[model samples]
Target: MKLKMHISKIKCINDLTIELPIERGLYAITGQNGSGKSTIVASASRVFFNLPMKEYFGDTVDGAMIEFELDGNKRSWHKKGKSWLQKQTGSMNIRGFYEGSLIYGYRFKDTTYEKLKKSESIDKAKLRPSHEFIRKNLGLILQGDEDYYEKLYEVPREYAKFDSSIFFYEKNGIQVSQFHMSTGENLLLSILNSLYIKNKERKNASKQCIIFLDEIELALHPSSLKRLVAFLEDMARQYDYAIYFSTHSIELISGIKPDNIFYIERYNDGTIGVNNPCYPAYATKFLYDHSGYDNVLLVEDDLAKSIVTRILRKEKLLNSRLVHVLPCGGFRNIIKLADDVTRNNLLGKRASICIIVDKDVKEQAIKYKKENGLASSCGMNFLPIESLEKYLRMSLVYNVDQKLFKRLSDYVFQQRSLQELIAEYRKLKEFDTDKNGKVLYSLLDTELRNRRTDRAELIDLIVEYLFEENKQPIQDIKKFLHKELE
Candidate 1:
C-alpha cells in the first residue's frame, strides 16, 4: 500500500522530528552533509524494512516515533528504551522488501539495491541485485507501456553485468562496467535496471512501492538532470511509488518545484528536521552570504522575485552593489523565514531582508512588523492586489509557463494592436475591480525565451513595453515600490 501521511518524531537520534507527505511523487531531502538527511532515510527504511526500533534508537535517549497512513489504515511505533511499543488502528498486511512492492534504497557505496561493492565474485546464493529486483517485480515492469520494454534495449541484458557486483552497459555488444560509461549514461542505466525490476514484479502483487535515494544527482549533466527529474516525477504518477532523496545541490533545488524541497537543518536547540519550511532561513542566508550579496529582498516565489528585482533596480531604490532577490518559496514560507533572517547582521553576510506577499498578506505582515519591529528594521509589504499574477491581470500570461506556447498566437493579438488588445480584454466578463490596473500587457509570456528569459529580463521587457505604450498601471507599480523603499 502507498504511504499517505507519514510523520516521524525523534530526539537525540540526530535530534529529528519531521512529518513527511511521503505520497506518490518526488520528495527531496535537502541540506548540508550530516544535517540528518540520511537519518530521515533511515527512519523510512526502519518502517518499511521491518527493523526493530532499537536498531536506530540503540543509543537514542530522548525517544522517537514513526506514525504513517497506509492502505486507509493508521499505524505507529515508538521507541521505549530497547523495545518498540507498537500501536495500530486498522488491519495491515505488513510486508518487507521481498513483498514485490515495498520501499527500496539506492544510497550508494553500501546500498541494499545493489550487491556490495566489496563482493569479488558472484555468489549465486544472494540474488543479483537487479535480478532479485527483476524476479520480484517482473510482471509490473512488463506491464509498463512501450517504455518498459524500451529500457532493456537501452540497457541491453547482453551488456548487463553482475559478476563484479556492479551493473554494466553494452557498447558495440561488449559488456563494459559502469566505469566505462559516461556518468549520465551510467546513472540512466542504473535507474532503468531498478525501474525494470519494479515493473517486472508489479504484475502479480497489490504492493505499492517507495524508493529512497541520496545524493542522486551525482555525475548528471544539467540537461540530463532536468530530464531525469521529469521522468521520475512522471513515473511516480504512472506507478504507485514514492521517491525520497537527499542532495546538497542548490542549483538542483532552484530548478525543482519549490514545494518538493525540504531543507533540513539543526536548530539552536540541536533539534533537526524541516517539516514544511518555506524559505529555510539558515540555508537561504548561507547560500546568499556565500554568494557574496550584502542586501536581499525575500519574496514569495521565483516570479515575484523577478518582478520585484526588476522594479527595485529600475527605480534605483536598492543599492545595485548589494541587493539580491531571494524567493522564500511562498507567503507562508516568507512568514516562517522572516523570524530568523530579519535579524540585523545575521550570518555575517545576511542582507537587510524585505518581505513581500499578496494583498491578502497585508494584515499579517503589518501585525508581524509591529510584533517584531520589522517595519522600520527592514521592510515589509503585501502587494496592492490579491496576487501578483492576478494583479498583473494579463489573461494570456495568466497561465504562462503552465502550458508552453499552446494556441498562444491564436488567443492573443490576432489582428488588434497592443492598445486595442488591452481594451478588448478589459471589457471581458473576467475583468472586474479585482483585476484593476493589470490590463495593459498582452497576456502571453514571452514566446520562446531567446536568451535567459528566466530572470528580470522578461519582466524588464514587459515593463518597457508598458512604459513605451504609456500604460498608467506600470507607473503606479513604480510609485508603489518607490514609496515602499522610502
Candidate 2:
C-alpha cells in the first residue's frame, strides 16, 4: 500500500507534501502539542475528523486544498472561494472502512465512562464501555468469521506474561468481568474491531487499506502501550494494512523502527510542516518543548547510559534532581533526539541535549544529516569505537598476560559468542575489557540476580581504567555537562 498526501492552507500547514514514497508499515506523526500532528491524521481520515473546510483557511487565503494518492489513484478535495469540489473519485472506501455504527463510527474526545461517572442518575449510568467494544471485536470471530481475527494468533510473545488481561468471554463454568479490563485493553479491542471492520470494507477484493489511529497511547499503561505497539507492528507486517499512527510518547517512537517514524511541527513562519524523524531539529524540539526532562544526555542504551551517569558522578556534576541519561533505544534515535534539540534551540526553550551515538552508525548518521541538511545543533558526537562495550573492553585492566592479548583479541574481535569469551576470560584468569558491551546494560538493572555476579562492581574496575587511561572522552563529556548544566 502507498499513500502520498499534500495539503495547503487547510489549517496551520501551508503547502505541505512529502516526496518520498510511503510504503505499507507504521508511520508515526509526533511533535509538540500544537504542531499540527493531529491535523495531518484528521485530514487523512476525513470521515472521522470532519471539520469545517473554511474554518481551516489561512489568513487572507480564499482557498484550501487537501489531496492524496491512495493505491496510485489520485483523489483531491478543494475549496475554492465559497465552493468545494472533489476532483477525482476512487474505489477505496475510507468511509466504508469505518465498518458499522456498532463499532463507534468515530472516536470521541471524552469517553462514555467519564460521562456515566459524572451523571447524577444511577439508572442511566450503569453501562460498561467494554461491552460494545469487546463484543464487536471478538463476537464475530467466535461465531464463524475467522479469516481476519485469525491473524491475532501471532500476538507478541510478551502477552503471555500479562498477569492481567482483557477477557471478552468465558465458556463452561468460569466467572469473568470479576477481572476488570483496563482502558488500554478496551481501546485495543476497539482498534482490532476497526481493522476487522476494514477487512469487511473491501471483502475478498485483496485491497489495501489505511488505518489512522490518533494519539493511540491514550489510557495505556506503559506495559500495555508497548504490547499494543508490538501487536500493531506485527499486524501491519502480516496483513495488507498500512498503519498511520500519532504519538508524543518517546517510548512508542523508540519501540518502532526509525524508518517508520515521522515528525510534524509548527515552523517559525506560523506554518506547520511534517518531516522525517531523522530531521536534526526534531529531537531538539522534542526534548525542549514536549518532554519533562530539563537536562538530558541521549545515549544508545542502558549500558552507555550507565557509563555516562558514572562519569558524571565522577565529575560531581550529576545533579540527581536535574540531569539524567536517557537511552533512546539505538543509534538511529540520534536523529530524533537531534530533531528535538534543533526545535528547542529555535524556540529558546533553554534545554541542554547532548547525544552520544554509536560509532557503527556514524556513516548513516552523517548521510542522513547531509540529506536533510539538519543544522548541527544537537551537539552530536560519535563513540570512538564500535559500541559502549568496545569502549569498556578496551578500557578494562589487562592483567595476568600480555601473551593472552592475541588470544583475547581473536575471541573478542571475531564476533564470537559472549559466553565463549567469558569462558576464555575465566580459564586464562585474565581481565579483558568488554568492547562488545553485552554486559553494560545488564549491569544497570536494579534487581539483583542470585547467581549472577555483581557486574556493577566490575564496571567500577573498568571505569577506573577509563578514568586513568582514557582522558579524552571524559573531557568531551565534561564539556557537554558544562554546557547543559550552565
Best candidate per TM-score, number?
1
Whole-model Cα lDDT of every candidate shown, in order: 0.52, 0.53
**RMSD of model 2 against the true structure:** 14.0
Return the TM-score for each candidate structure.
0.56, 0.48
lDDT of 1 by residue, 1-486 (tens): 245434345533343445555457776777766577666665666555664555443555435676766667777777676667778888543332211111223313234334334332333233223453332222232233323322222222323243213553233555444544455444444566667667667667565566766565666655555655666677777775676666665545555555567787667676665745344443443544434555566677555665667677777877645676677655555654655554544535544556677665677667765675543555566543345445355434354332312332333324433344545666766667534333333242332222223434444444444345545545666775665455
For residue 400, what is the lDDT in candidate 2? 30
lDDT of 2: 0.53
- lDDT (Cα, tens digit) per residue for candidate 2, span 1-486: 346778877666777875322345766777777777766776666432344544333332556777877666677778766776667665544332221112232432233554433332222123223333335434342323323232222111133222222233333543233124444544555566556555555456455566777776666666656666666676676665667666777667766554466766566788665555343223323443335556667777545666678767877775654675765655655565566466646324654566777777878877887787664566677653456445544433233323334443443323443335445554542233434544533332222233244445444444554566568876776676666666
Candidate 1 has its poorest 10 consecutive residues by lDDT at 95-104
| Residue 307 lDDT, candidate 1, scale 0-100 | 61
For candidate 1, what is the total of clashing residue pairs? 15
